[model samples]
Target: MFKNEELEINLGPQHPSTHGVLRVKLRLDGETIVKCTPIVGYLHRGVEKICENKTFFQGQVWTDRMDYVAAVSNNLGWAESVEKLFGIHVPRRAHYVRTMMTELNRISSHLLWLGTHALDIGAMTVFLYAFREREQILDCFESFCGARLTTTAFRIGGLREDIPPGFIKQVQAFQDRFLDCIDEYETLLTENRIWKRRTIGIAPINADECIAFGVTGPVLRAAGVKYDVRKAFPYAAYAEMNFEIPTRTEADTYARYLVRLEEFRQSHHIIQQCIDGLPEGNVMAKIPKVLKSEVNEIYHPIEAPKGELGYYLVGEKGGQNPYRFHVRGPSFVNLQALPQMTEGRLLADVIAAIGTLDVVLGEVDR
Candidate 1:
């Protein structure tokens, strides 16, 4: 008699497919995973611990680095939290601009995912194509705040800078050309046989399991629950803007792909609305030279690329320094389901599953 023996295998802390310093210890029977454990913390930069030492205003910059893929949205979350703690309201124009940049960041994130995800699935052209588009968005970030990644352009009271005079035209140009680019991406992989074979029905889970696991973003939406923070609980003028929540019921790798594809379109619409209806006002609310003195703060919010971001701040009375600060990141919570989600799947499917989760290690390990 012949029997299959169990084997324990290591996926990576250095593997490119694991998406940034994630190491998986897998117990397997033949090629099938029996039990899986994800080991992280390789990238823990002590962001929270570092925040405690910095002033509230200074701490907000650290949030930008927590998720390099969508730093503007990360910045928005921290700024909103600090504003909430201080009880200060941003101007209408600042609200509109924040919405604009955040939506752009969302599209950029999805593009990065699409490219890298496609590359993992064996579509070579997509990696270059996706990064090509990403470079343009990063250029916009540089033009606005001088940093392509980890942009700390949002302030506690409002935006760090206003849109330059010709910036609107540049943004509009990107929008105009975006449809063709999207169509090209879809053409390459959306209905491709290999892509579908690698993704469909792989490591399936339902909405119940996803909710129980506390999964959010495309993972939850792919399970058929349309619980987007933007739609369910609107912030950053999202309530005023027009957009739709993209959902699917497959709860498989393919469903997650479709959900993200639909999301890209919805985000595009939101950006156009923000640009069209942008209000006029001071880019930033005037603050005292001493950040530790003068005003406290107010409410602020912007829809991040991942999901709803909740921020709360406690600041010193009559000082600009924040006494307390907290940020709720969607990626960290979303990643909690990895072991549960990856168990019972093949090793090849493990990579497929993680790609569908779309986790950035910086956010996951933050």
Candidate 2:
């Protein structure tokens, strides 16, 4: 008689596929994952604690580092939170510009995800093709804010400055050509035999389970939940924007891929609307040099590219800094579902599972 034995292994704190300093302790039985535990905090910078020491205005820069891929979205969330806490209303032009920037950020973030996730699943060609379009978006970012990645693009009351001359034309150029690029990516993977074989039924979960686990973003939406922070709790001109919340009932890796892909198109639509209906007004509201808050506490949540990125601020009567500052990073919450998805699956499927979650370890660990 032959005996089956269980083996324990560590996936990474150094493995590239783990998507940053994330280590997974896996109990395996003949290549099947029997149990999984995710180990994090290798990249922790005490971001929340650090915010408490910095003034409210200064803390805006730190939000960029949390989800470094979509820094504009982080800027929007934090700026809006500060504005809310101070009871300052942003001007109409600032609202439209912020919305446009955030939607562009969403497309960029999703492009990165699609490229890397496809690469993880063994589609190298898609990776190269995706970055080509991504570069155009980055070019727009650089021209607008002079910074590409960690752009501190938003001010508390509004934007730092108005869009430069020809900025609208550049965005329009990208908009006109972007859909064909999405179609190219889809042709590569959407119906490819290998992609479907690898992802179609992998890591499937129901809507209830996702909600129970506090998962958000494409992961939750793929489970057939129509919950989108932009739609449900509109902010930064989202209430005025017309877009669809893409969802799928399959709740598998393939479904997540589709949901994110659809999001790219929707983001493009919102950006077009912003460009067409952009209001003419002051970009920056008149705000005091020294910002103080009297609100006891406030929590503002926004639909970031990854998920619901929220800032919880505890304000002091006269202090320039928040007494208590915390962030609800979607990557961190969505990552908790990894073990549930990976357990009982083959070791190779772990890569696909993590890729589909679209988690950034910078956000996860912070």
The lDDT leader among the candidates is 2
By summed lDDT, the worst window of 10 consecutive residues in model 2 runs over 291-300
- TM-score list, all predictions: 0.93, 0.99
Q: What do the candidate models score in CA lDDT, each in turn?
A: 0.80, 0.93
> What ranges in model 2 sit over 4 Å off?
1-3
Tens digit per residue, CA lDDT, model 1, 1-366: 977789998999999998899888999998878999888888988877678578777887788888889998888788766666645688888989888888889989999999888888788998888788788888888887888888887887888778877888878888888878888888888899999999999868798988887777888888998888787767677889988888889889889888888887887898899889988878777765555534443434345666555565555666545555555667777667878777877788888877878888897787
Candidate with top TM-score is: 2
Model 2 per-residue lDDT tens digits across residues 1-366 = 877999999999898887898999999999999999999999999999999999989998899999999999999999999988989999999999999999999999999999999999999999999899889999999999999999999999998899999999999999999999999999999999999999999998789999999999999999999999999999989899999999999999999999999999999999999999999988998999998778589999999888888899999889899999999999999999999999999999999988999889999998
* lDDT minimum window of 10 residues, candidate 1: 293-302
- Check candidate 2 and list the clashing pairs: none
RMSD of each: 2.5, 1.0
Model 1 misplaced stretches (Cα beyond 4 Å): 1-3, 289-303, 312-324
